[model samples]
Target: MERNAVEERVAQHYAGGIYAPDRAPEDMAIQSDTLFMFLMGEAGQREDMEAWMVRMAEAMDRIQELMDVLEARAEEKEESGAA
Candidate 1:
C-alpha cells in the first residue's frame, strides 16, 4: 500500500478513537501484531494489512515517546540525587 493511504487510515483511526487510551502500548503492539498475523493467515486484503501496520506504527511511536519521557525524568532524578 502507498504511504499516503496508510497515513490517512492512521489519522482516521486516531480520530475515530479506535485506540483505547487505557491500554498499555506494549499490549497494543502485541495485539496488533497478532491480529495482523491472523488476518494474513486468513487471506486478508491490502487494506487490512495497511491498517494493521499503521496501528502498530502508532503504538510503537507512543511507546518510544513514553520511553523518552521516562529517560528524561530518570536523568533529572539522577542529577538531583533524588533516587
Candidate 2:
C-alpha cells in the first residue's frame, strides 16, 4: 500500500482505540527494544538477517515519523489548554 493509505489506516485504527495513547510511548519503547534484541539474537542464526534488518529499519523510521507527528499534536493541545 501507499504511504498515505498506510497512514490513514493507522489513524483510523488509533481513533478506534486499537492502541491506547496513554501507554503508547512506553509500549512502543518496550516493543522496539524487544524487536532489536530478537533481531540481534537471530542475526547469528539467519543468513538473510541483513535484508530483514534493512526492511525493519525502514518500517521503524516510518513509525517514528508517525509518533513524532502524534507527539507534536499532543503537545500543541497541552499548550493550548495551558494558555
Candidate 3:
C-alpha cells in the first residue's frame, strides 16, 4: 500500500481521542503499558472493559493491604532521629 493510501484510509476511519472533563483533546494523556494491558485483557473476555477493570481493582486492593501491613510494622518499631 502506498503512503498516501494509508493516510487516506486513516483519515477516513479515525474517530477522535478521549479527553478528560474540561480538558481539550491536546491535553489528553495515555500510558502505553496500561493501554496495552487493558486491550489484552479485553481480548480474552466476551464483555468490554468491565472484567479487566474489576481485576485492576482487586490488584489495587491487594497492594493497599500490603501497604497497611508495612505501616503497622513501622509503627511498632522505634524511630531513631540520628543525624
Candidate 4:
C-alpha cells in the first residue's frame, strides 16, 4: 500500500534518527500526556490486538526488504572485487 501524507511526514521527520521533533513544548507535553493515558489503561482490551499485531508483521516485512537490498548490494560489490 502507498504511504499516506501523515506517514510520509513522520518518516521524513524520523529518518535522521530518534531525535525530538521541532514542535512547541506545549505540543510535546500534550503528546506525552496522551501517550501516558493510553499506556495506563485507555489503550484497549486484549481482544483488540489484531491491529498492533499486523503492524508488527509489517515492520518485520520492511526490515526484510531492507536486508534484501543490502544483500544484493553486497553481492554486486563482491562480483566487482570492491573489497
Candidate 5:
C-alpha cells in the first residue's frame, strides 16, 4: 500500500528470485491484496497487521522486480532482432 513499503517488498522479491519477470507484478498485486484482506477480516491489531504487512510487502516487491526483469528481457530480445 505505502510506496516505500511496496518498494522494499519488491526489492526483497528481486533478491529472492521468487517469481518470473512476466508474472511478478500481477502476482505481487494479488498476494498483497490477499494479505491485506486477511488481516482486515481477522481484525488483526496493529502489530499483527504490521507483521503480515511486512511479509506481504516483500512479496509485492518481488513481483514488481520480476515484471521488470521480464520486460527487460523482452526489450533486449527485440533490440537484438531475436523476437
Candidate 6:
C-alpha cells in the first residue's frame, strides 16, 4: 500500500478506539536473560553480527535525529508563541 494510504488506515484504526494513545511507556531496564535472548535472536538472523549491530545503531540514530527536530520545533513555537 502507498504510504499515505497506510497512514490513513492507521489513523482510522486509532480513531476506531482500539488503542489508548495516552498510555505511558514503562521505564524499565532490560533483564540479563531477556537481553541474552534478544541478542541470540538477532545473531540467529544473520551470518555476521556486525550487520545487526549496524541496523540497530542506524535505527537509534534516526530516532535521535527525529527527537532533536521535534525539540527544536517546540522551542521555536515557545519563543514565537505560534501555538
TM-score of 5: 0.42
lDDT of 1 by residue, 1-83 (tens): 22334333443455353432334435656367664334333323335655667656776898899999999999999999998
lDDT of 5 by residue, 14-37 (tens): 436343233433466646766433
Cα lDDT for residue 36, candidate 6: 35
Minimal lDDT window, size 10, model 4: 37-46
Model 2 accuracy (lDDT, Cα): 0.51
Steric clashes per prediction: 0, 0, 0, 0, 7, 0
Q: Per-residue CA lDDT of candidate 3, range 5-82, in tens?
A: 322332233234231222222333424335533433343442434555576577789889999998877766636432
Off by over 4 Å in 2: 1-47
- Which lDDT tens digits does candidate 4 get at residues 1-83? 23334333333444352323334324565356543323212222223445544554776798899999999999999999997
Tell me, by TM-score, which candidate is best: 1
Error (Å) of candidate 4 at residue 25 is 22
Cα lDDT for residue 25, model 3? 21
**Poorest 10 consecutive residues by lDDT, candidate 6:** 18-27
Candidate numbers, best lDDT first, in rank order = 1, 5, 2, 6, 4, 3
lDDT of 6 at 71: 100
Q: lDDT by residue for model 6 over 1-83, one digit each (tens)?
A: 12233233332344363322322223133133354334434544545546766765886898899999999999999999998
User: Which clashing pairs does model 6 show?
Assistant: none
Q: Per-model C-alpha lDDT, please? A: 0.53, 0.51, 0.44, 0.48, 0.53, 0.50
TM-score of each: 0.45, 0.42, 0.40, 0.43, 0.42, 0.43
Estimate the TM-score for candidate 1. Answer: 0.45
Q: Model 3: runs farther than 4 Å from truth?
A: 1-47, 79-83
Per-residue lDDT of 67 in model 1: 100
